[model samples]
Target: MRALKLVGKTLNFEVESLGIIEWYIHAIISYQIINYEVLPADTKTPIEVIIDQLSSLSLSIDSKNLVSKNYFQKMKEDKLRKIYPYFLKMLNNPSLSLSLSLSLSLSSLQTIKIIIILDIQIFIKLMKYLKI
Candidate 1:
């Protein structure tokens, strides 16, 4: 019974650590989006790289630990389930626009527009999934 309790405590710690990591990732992404204009040009790529690394690490962890795999998978699914409505509302609200009309180059504007459209598409797909 002591061994079992030890296992339980370790699993709980791992799960909580994963949650903290995920929360930090989300917070960083949100901060970048909100402060895009002031961010350095190289900022976005590094964040993407970190996220990709984290994703691969998570996948490896999942493959090695069945319990953690199940927990993380459910966590991801639950986040997706809850995100669509909030995302749709953000897209629909003009006040929440990320546009910066501060004489940005045409290429920059185009990039921003493309990113926004892609996000909208993903959110729309999520909405459809929820409806089904």
Candidate 2:
């Protein structure tokens, strides 16, 4: 989790355009951020606060809802989908974190599919949510 904080901080730097790498990073970090188990949220835990801010979810999962891990993943997807704009716009970053880089670098045989066949000029302008 601490490592995630560092990567998150590093990715926070301003970048005009993001690539597939950034998508993987944000997906992983946002996944961890959204799904990391913490307080019950009655006290409004930091994770819950972040989640609520991200996807407007209360994120107070009870024992009754703990049917299976897939259930959580499925539910998380709905919330995660709401949050990620190609990658969760994590504090305005939406870019690569370390763990994701490690995974991509460590693996070679993974088959890839890029569904978004975007025009070059429009791609750079899409991910950066900047005032300038």
Candidate 3:
């Protein structure tokens, strides 16, 4: 979660385009929410604030800026790998899992499926740890 905040903050300063920053922020918030169970209480509040801001943005603008290809790749390699344990926690909550599945981009979903196939042992370990 801290890493996410750092990424968000860094992108906020480094990216000149509002559209790109907004897109990245939205992706970060979505990823955080999907893995909420592992986050600390203090971290949750800031993420909620970001979500509120995200909600206020025009949907048309968001759609126009939503380029999931590069963002999804970065998320998978950087954020997702770092939070795989929390992602497994997400599976324990049926509601969260359902929402996450529903919210994911098609490419992101495909990436996850491929990861699971390639890292079956890690997936098995996570499931076992959760006693699922």
Candidate 4:
């Protein structure tokens, strides 16, 4: 209960991307509930206590990976790897397609118009191709 409340409180209610956030939250909660149910009652542990233990056991990745490539580069790669599976899962959700389709329509048109508008010579050449 305490862990659940903590997770709930950490959620940014004002953020515009609630659907993505909720997807992660529900995924985490489901994982926790399923694991807890499988564990024997005598062996069960509070989520906070488990988290605290894990925090204490945290190990830093090798500094060599950071020095040559920079920390942000490694961190970015790690974040992409972690989220890639979840992103694929989200792609399977039907409602998400609607938002993606709407975004793609504007993006594709905007990209073409930008290239034409930004290059007047190119626009004129294209018009000649059309005999306009």
| lDDT (tens digit, per residue) of candidate 4 on 38-75 | 22221244434333332332122442221232322344
TM-score of each: 0.19, 0.20, 0.19, 0.19
CA lDDT for candidate 4: 0.32
- What RMSD value applies to candidate 3? 18.2
Better of 1 and 2 by TM-score: 2
lDDT per residue for candidate 2 within 59-105, as digits (tens), equals: 22442232332333454544544433323334444332322211122
> Which residues of candidate 1, in runs, are more than 4 Å off?
1-23, 37-54, 57-71, 76-78, 81-132
The candidate maximizing TM-score is 2
**lDDT to native, each model:** 0.33, 0.36, 0.35, 0.32
- Clash pairs, candidate 2, are none
Per-residue lDDT, model 4, residue 24, is 35
lDDT of 1 by residue, 1-132 (tens): 233235435444211110111123344344334533232233233443333333433222233432342333344433433332222223334343343232223453442222122234444453354342
User: Candidate 1 vs candidate 3: which has greater lDDT?
Assistant: 3
Tens digits of lDDT, candidate 3, 1-132 = 354344435434221111112224445446556545344323333433333433443322164564433333343233433433322323333332121121223454342221111134544453454344
Query: Of the pair 1 and 3, which is ahead by TM-score?
Result: 3
> How many steric overlaps are in each model, in order?
0, 0, 0, 0
Q: Root-mean-square deviation of each candidate, in angstroms?
A: 22.8, 13.2, 18.2, 18.6
